[model samples]
Target: MGQGQQEQVATSLAGAVSEEISASLAPVDAELERRYPGDPGTRQPVHTVYVPGDAFAADTIRSWGDQALAALDEHAPNAASFAAVLGLSDELAEPVHSRVRAKLEHEPIEDLRVDFEDGYGPRPDAEEDETAARAARLIAEAFKNGTAAPYMGIRMKCMESAVRDRGIRTLDIFLTGLMEAGPLPDGLVLTLPKVTYPEQVGAMVRLLEAFEKARGLEPGRIGFEIQIETSQSILATDGTATVARMIQAAEGRATGLHYGTFDYSACLGVSAAYQASDHPAADHAKAIMQVAAAGTGVRVSDGSTNVLPVGPTAKVHDAWRLHYGLTRRALARAYYQGWDMHPRHIPTRYAAVFAFYREGFAQAAARLARYANRTGGDVMDEPATAKALSGYLLRGLDCGALDIAEVARLSGLTRADLESFATPRRGDLTASGK
Candidate 1:
């Protein structure tokens, strides 16, 4: 072939390839555009603490915190080590004792999901109602007593018809009993577990709306989290990813999608020994969740480590160590939240999270400040980089890893500058003198 003819053919082939790519990805782009509300990324708790419905009480968390602190003291060498483990400065050594006390006494429960499913399990129908009502009463007492966490909710049974009636009944009874004490607490959510179809989420939204109206609350006053448990929820029979579709079915009310460790792993046929948050199937599900729910602002949480760090007969430092290792793995995967099945896990949870934020804070703060000041640094600061740094700082602030004064001292930027960068915007992020 002639050289000119060959060049023309190559150009035509490139154009065709581009068209094919765009055509194949049109649905993905469209799905992204219309994703439902996920975690706002404004502030998310590091873990969702679940207690059985029949057993939950406001002071239960304080007891857990107390136990956690006691466990740490019983295990950790000294005050310095404790402070160091939590990424606290020397000054904090004195106050962190009281701080830890206050945290336990006040808001130790970050995300509380009173479980009616596996945690509560299938019980006598009356027993289920009684447990649900008891949970409602305790949570309501917490609300009036000002002991509730920032995020509190209930996890109902799967809406798979077999238990759908029972799930809805439990929710209804809980809400009714809760309102009798006072108005609903802030950041309340309903967790619908074992989702298999998009329509189930839509139905839950409608149910919440009706509950609001019946209670004389505003529309959209309630929100929900979908537990990603079954294979069907992740991959539709239609041969497309369906998690986004499930969130969409929420109609702007899905706050997060939580991975159910055992059920999800079981669905994938992972043996009991291999089923874990770090498993490949679990990671794939989370990756799909991240893509479908990223820009949509939905929070993605990894599944729990079934292994608790505590031993019935011993200190079980090795158990705690293994738990910490797994926690670090989850953090490395950018999943800041997981499940703390036991009080001892709480200490390990904060330890891992503190290490993550502290190790990166110096570099992140410098890069972020330099980016904000339009000054060149060792690293080029792009918009996404700025946002990530801002998020890192915000998360640190939320989780108590970094305080305002500490942030100011480290980042060399004002709180206002931090907030400004935190909200994402589209633009060229050219470093000055780059």
Candidate 2:
């Protein structure tokens, strides 16, 4: 062929490729529109917190089971909702259930999460696969028994096989068994730990799509929560664009983002000597995640405080309790949904959540009410004033410190007006509420 003919062929191929790329992206764009019709970035307030019971350590698991149940019993009156973590081990399954039943004798249990790793990282050996399968079976059986806990989920291993090898396979087998045995659990949360990039999450989303298809389930049925434990994930050089990509890749399958405090601190060489939870550095990381997840409908949660003393003391315990409360409040103010690693942490969890929301709601209501009364349509004449008032109301709503109705009422504005100004602001409110 002549040079001109060859060049023409190359141009034609390039155009074809471009057309194919556009065709492929069209559905993703349409689906995104369908999933997020109003504002693709507006974050819905996350009111509930899911506490992982650290199912890997037997002693910790048992203790958490007891503490969780006790907390539920003592605080159920004030508790909005609760979730328990169960390790997927045949050996531990019975004990976990027995404890769960015992603890829930007084109060109702709503959710159970089976942690695939028993805590010593993932077991890559073939023998361990058998053991894992057995554990998965046991958990399925327990869920089939129709206990009070309606929500069943699993925290599958992360991408790192050394840390949790049974990542995809375990989920493949467990979900198959659960579906085959009976109805699908109320919800399935695939917790991805040690996530460094959005592509890691996107990969899971693709696998989940395949799994859902193979299992004859609807696409996007399974929900995912990314553990933002690495410094890279939280503080990307591109301003959390990577995190945004990962959330977007989840394609609406992503539900929440969790902070992995100890792991993250370890990654950053932050000393373990000091509690990772509530460390200023950890707070900074959480803030970054909160910003990344803004307007994404994904809830963010802080990592757990690991400083709980084994034994109880009146004053010492109270001090520890206060510390936990402060940590939870900090996370709550950031608009994250869940925390991890301990059940005894529930008291402070509830305290911080209630205090944060209650105070936030009250303040927001007052401010919005004032804004509504003071700024009528007359304010709309001044673009600068309108923007300023809209900005104030939107920030309060975004932080979960205020509600949409209040924002609407205060600004004499519609919900659309408030939502239009929903952009995350830095230093508007400190995590510590100072």
Candidate 3:
């Protein structure tokens, strides 16, 4: 083509591109106006809670109740004490309920888990005729009397073959009965144990779907909390992929991932002499779960700190509590909520959560503030500066150390500035003190 013809074509192409860019900017401007009109500088705080589900038991209903009350009075004074209780059948429920009530009279509590059954393996033949019926009756009674705790929940058995052989059937019957008896409780978290693969999760999802349909409940009303107990679930050679697959398979059905530190350590042949929660095996297992759950909204919880001291002596017990605090903090830093198996451990639980967030957020804010001061331009140009600023923002957001707006304000940046720094060619920040 002649030079004149080629130049004309290039000019037309550039005009078309400009028009496309203009069209795209129009909606972006409108969205900015709708979401942040005259409020470009406004920042919002990120509210995040590190949920520690109860792995602790008071030994008896009375003691459990008393301890729960005392703990609430002590550590979670403003917050309600939450408990997860277990019962094999309806006959067992009343006895358990009566015990919990006596303790709560002194101290208020929130949350309860009426375990449908205990232990693993096939459900007993008696389970069908008696256990299921009795559990349903007791739950109905609890509902009618309004004596049941405010935050009530039910823990269905895990998805082992033995459970499928019996417990699954029992669960079907029990869930149906519970639905008919009253409104489904505040929430339902299927406690799946020994879940080795995605197919297993898929199985649970299917079952939950069917139950919801039968009960005329929302299709995804129920959620799951998977227990990463077995070595096979974490080790690649032993079907670790299955665990990752299972999580993906459950998709919207999963709420959280919990590490079974003791069980995982045992599966790895770690000596009984070692502390399960602190063992290297346990760390690796938790790291695996953390990596798997990277972008998934599902929360991850660490296993309980099983050591229970006789009494609270800050001098003697301080080391124990600190160690526990550090472990919980590490998990929290890794973005996993941890479990507190005993009430005395609550102090450590809250302490770790507070320290991790406070320290992390402050440090990130300081660093981002420094970067902001160092760079004056609306668009950052230095490679190292841009990378550090971008990384600090992302890590802060991931750990709940800083929200997007806070990151922007502290870094003297806009959302577009941070996003541009996140582009592949720019890369992540370099390690400090290297």
Candidate 4:
């Protein structure tokens, strides 16, 4: 072919490929929208703290938060230096300091995940099943007594070949036991890890549907977050991205996409010594996840910084530095949520999050207001910008770094406006896990 003809042919092929993908997606897209009709909105938790299912207790997070604060006092150089690192003003520092003490005395855990996967490990099948049942009972009891964490869920092992049936059985036992105790608690969901095929997601949705039918619960009641841990999870057999396909397979039950740091890095052939949250491979996966889930209302969370803040023998400073840096990077990339592996990370998580939200908030809020009013000539306030700006403050409000009153004043938005921008939160921290 001539040069121009060759170029035209290449363009035709590209357009054909795009058209094929779109046509294949059309039905799934339509179904997803009809099932999840009005805006999917946002449900961004700053962090997910995973604990072994067998060890779960309603008050465990608060205990861990308290312990973290005590360690700070017994090991740190001075209160001021710690305050500086947390970016706490003297006034803010006092409250954070007191909040830690109070959180320990009260509710410490914000978002907790009971893990039957790596965190819990593979025990005897019967023993694991029993533990799942027991955890379910504990969670239901806490809900009945109005003591459950605001956001709580279970992380089962991968639903893929090797452990598929085991994961399903554990999930079935847990949900069955929990529902038997009482009504499903608000904000309960499942976390499906290492999803390498769309069929795995479809199977999970079908399983949840069965649970609802058996328990007389609503369909789509048990939503889930799909963990993108392997390269194959992102790459479909047809040479297209599968994030959308997995969410589509959920049939309106997929709530978020969570990246698995170490596993994803390993999948990319990274050595154990170099695998971290910000590894190139991990970031690439997260970026794809973010793009795939954007506008779909499927929240995207960066994986945890595995380096726990276990101390006395370890410098908390090093842990804090790593956590803070990773957090800031995630926040900057518009990924508001992440995972926390240690209780000592509670303070650092909040500190990093609050600092992120507080920074550029004033300027962003002002710009948002001007854009809405059509006074900021250079600023074109689009849906994405509005979501980002509002999310930043909503996170602050959730963390108590910014209150409704402050948000209204700074953003020129009303109480209802701010409230409407985000999901219903279990109120602010009370028992300070300082």
Top candidate (TM-score): 1
Where model 4 places Cα greater than 4 Å from the true spot, the runs are 1-39, 76-79, 84-107, 312-314, 377-380, 419-434
**Number of clashes recorded per candidate:** 5, 9, 6, 11
Which candidate, 2 or 3, would have the higher TM-score against the true structure?
Answer: 2
lDDT of 2 by residue, 1-434 (tens): 76666444334365789889989999987775544432234443322223332332223234554676565454332222222221123433333334334433432323345565435344555644554455455555655554323444666678764543357777777677667667666544557777887778878888888888987888778877887877888657866556666777788887778777778888888877865666788778777767766656676766666565234444335544554455546644654444434555544443343344434444444454454455443222233333344544554455433456755454456767555433323222223354
- Model 3 lDDT tens row, 259-297: 776777777888777856667787777777877764454
Global lDDT scores for all candidate models = 0.79, 0.55, 0.52, 0.76
| Segments of candidate 1 deviating more than 4 angstroms | 1-41, 77-106, 312-315, 426-434
List per-candidate RMSD values in Å: 7.2, 14.4, 13.0, 10.3
TM-score of 3: 0.58
Worst 10 residues of 2 by lDDT: 78-87
Worst 10 residues of 1 by lDDT: 425-434
**Cα lDDT over the full model 1:** 0.79
Which window of 10 residues has the lowest lDDT sum in candidate 4? 425-434
User: How far does residue 195 in candidate 3 sit from its true spot (Å)?
Assistant: 0.8
User: Residue by residue across 1-434, what tens digits does model 4's lDDT show?
Assistant: 66666443334366789889999999987765565343355445678889998788767766777777776676553547666655566755654555445554565667788999988887999899888998888888877887777788799988868888999999999888877887788868689998988898999998988989988887778999999998998877788888878877887788889998888888889999889988888877888887777656678888888787775534677777788888888888888888888877777777666666665567867876775576765766554455556666766777655567766787789755755543322121112232
TM-score (C-alpha) between model 1 and the true structure: 0.85
